[model samples]
Target: MSAAGSGPEDLARGVLEGGARSIGRAISEVERDSVTVPAILRRVFPRTGRARIIGITGPPGAGKSTLVQRLAQAYRRAGRRVGIVAVDPSSPFTGGAILGDRIRMSEIYTDPGVFIRSMATRGALGGLARATSDAVDVLDAAGFDPILIETVGVGQDEVDIVRAADTIAVVLVPGLGDDIQAIKAGILEIADVFVVNKAEREGADRAVAELSMMLDLAGHPEWRPPIVKTSAPSGSGVPEAVAALEAHGAHLAASGEGRRRRSLRARSRLLALLETRFRRAIEARAPEPDGLEQAVAAVAERREDPYSAAARLFEELVPPPREAAERRSG
Candidate 1:
């Protein structure tokens, strides 16, 4: 079992059986590493891969929260249990999260079929929580039909959420200047869906047209990502957006693309696991006394070349490049 299974599975089983307090406490424990989550995951992980993980990202102030709320409502009407993960940004000064998704989706919190969790970025890139994929596995096992992950609206860096989701939705507002330039080529290319929010504003069509034109230029394969217009506040175009998302989900099912995409996601998650294990190993080795400080101080005093000092530190603390290859071969 690869040295996994460090803890009892009874708690997680209780979580699956809809024990609310058990689920919450286990999630917190996993988050803080009070237990080895990776070990636990290996024991409990089974990829049903049925939930369509939809990632909604956009520039800040794009009404993503409202749009997600509307989407969740639509899914509920369709008779599906929905799981929502809203990733809010971390406060730079306090090193704490300022989570704010509850205000947007308050209507559905008490819904019998809906489960919502707001996770702070916790300084993870792609604006996802450090334990997001783990949490997604939990929701998936608990039988949530549609899992929606909403990231703090940022640019390309946050778009890495595509690796975690089956469909990627990039939200943009109407009348925003430099819509294409704002999104940049990096994240735009990965989108499976693009939504223009606040359709009531002026230049709505222009924004849509711009995105369409960009998509055309990119020559996206398999299927071109659909662009939808929505105004979540007034509930305009929400139905259409929902329809488009549902259609996309159906296509994934029929084309066997759902399995393929999730397999890719699984592979990505595994690589992340190995990387995390490696990082933990390195940290556990305990760095030499004042190593980083000595290097920095040396550079400040102009006593040695910074590049050479960095090379030396890497060699001393980390497995050498050649030895890493040897271990892999072994």
Candidate 2:
């Protein structure tokens, strides 16, 4: 733990120097929701913003893991250090990460320049573990150039997790009828690049055509998501997909969208932190044990509605001005 004699400051320094053990431990701290995460991030924040965060998401059976493996290899070959956070579905019994994705990428498991971590979604609806952004920060501080986040393959809600990425690639495959239409209104809106994986399949061309039509109907903006066809096993179109990713990065830099995206990420992180702190504070000041049980019982019996109970709790925590004034006068 970072909280040992050397402390979070030491851990942060190790992370900045790209110590592999330190990076792994730091990410573990974040995953465990340690109290030291904020302190560690404070020390390493300056070293961040250097890594380009890329998010990969899609429906199940989209071959996302295979595509991610190929992309990581391409980046490594190009001399870029890659950090991969593979968000996997949680094991129902243990609440731990399922290692299927990691197992699929076994070939690159030992690569020195590539670091991969499999995280369980832990019931988060966004297809990402709650600690995902924090894990990315740890990787960034460790000087990973291109950080990749692979979401659990939940179609519509995948966008929430990938919003943290500088460029989001939505992976889709052929022969999945109506999949495009199902996700078009949500994840499609967040994509900077659309990937047609298993493009050699029968309906691959039709899938591409449908995506093109959707992009057209969405109204041509200054930055249109480019669709890249990829057949991962054969390494087909992998380079082109990488090129599209790089192009989007270039576009973000040239158009100043990168700064805007960073700002949004910062704002969202701050709000989440604030919400967490506020909840903790309220919990610390929770009603007396018996009172709490009574309240719960009331709600369970439907004698007191949850909404009204919540309002009462809020008022008790932060008294209304009128009540405070009356108390002062009295």
Candidate 3:
């Protein structure tokens, strides 16, 4: 399909037909927040909500990429089509990804059953790219099952980004800095499955034990997260990890958390879209370039407060109901 004249309907049809080029274009629109995004997403929304979104996150050296590779292979072996979204850090100068995970996934890079896309975070914090969800939606609409999202590995505090996933696996390794204490507070709650990768390395058993203790201390969870040990390099324990993820998926579906999770994700996306729209509207209402500069200078010098300035701008975009009625009548 030609990007120039292709409307949302054409693009939606192309995506549902599982054409890689069409899906790539769809995700590009999502990342760039193009004018056609709303229409494209609206048309494709019904085709989503079927793929299992599983997130793998951890520190830089925890081997997340390798583990994701093995997991994708395992899924493909079972005759399931896999899609991977690897969120990588963007270069400061060019705003492109450095060390994209696709480089590391050379083995499966050519697999027809696997679709892999590396997304530059573009300064979005908390591990995930801002448009990662939209990209996942495109993959879902393309009929890929079990989409895997590998985060930028921002460690503990950034784990919240994985809340978008139906099942989150937090990868850990032995010999990392205070591994248990550092992650217990922030990652423990959101993690659905714990993976101790590089299991043959020193202190692997100890790491597993510490994670177990922390889970115990976190109190009784209705569905306790299972810890699976993996040596991704040798491809050991990968099946167990995959099984654990599947089991968690089943638990979520049976207990109705699946619906709740989707609802929460949708709510977040809606709020983000609203915030973006409002910001654009406010920018469009700016008086003049010089006037806008003066307004910023005033705020910086404390001559005007930010809240008042924001309220004033909002009033211009959306007048009060009574004021609007009076203007209409007059």
Q: Go through the candidates in order and give each one's C-alpha lDDT.
A: 0.71, 0.79, 0.78
User: Please, what is the TM-score per model?
Assistant: 0.78, 0.84, 0.86
Q: After superposition, how far is residue 309 of candidate 2 from its true place, in Å?
A: 3.9
| Model 2 lDDT tens row, 136-222 | 888998889799988744555556667778999989998766766776666778889999999998999988898888889887577
In model 2, the clashing pairs are: none
The TM-score-based order of candidates, best leading, equals 3, 2, 1
Model 1, span 104-219: residue lDDT tens: 45668778687777664455563243466766776776778798887755554566554578888888887766756855665676677889999999989998998888888888
The order of the candidates by lDDT, greatest first, is: 2, 3, 1
Candidate with maximal lDDT: 2
Error (Å) of candidate 3 at residue 98 is 13
Question: What TM-score does structure 2 among the candidates reach?
Answer: 0.84
| Candidate 2 wrong stretches, greater than 4 Å | 1-6, 90-107, 123-129, 153-157, 287-308, 318-330
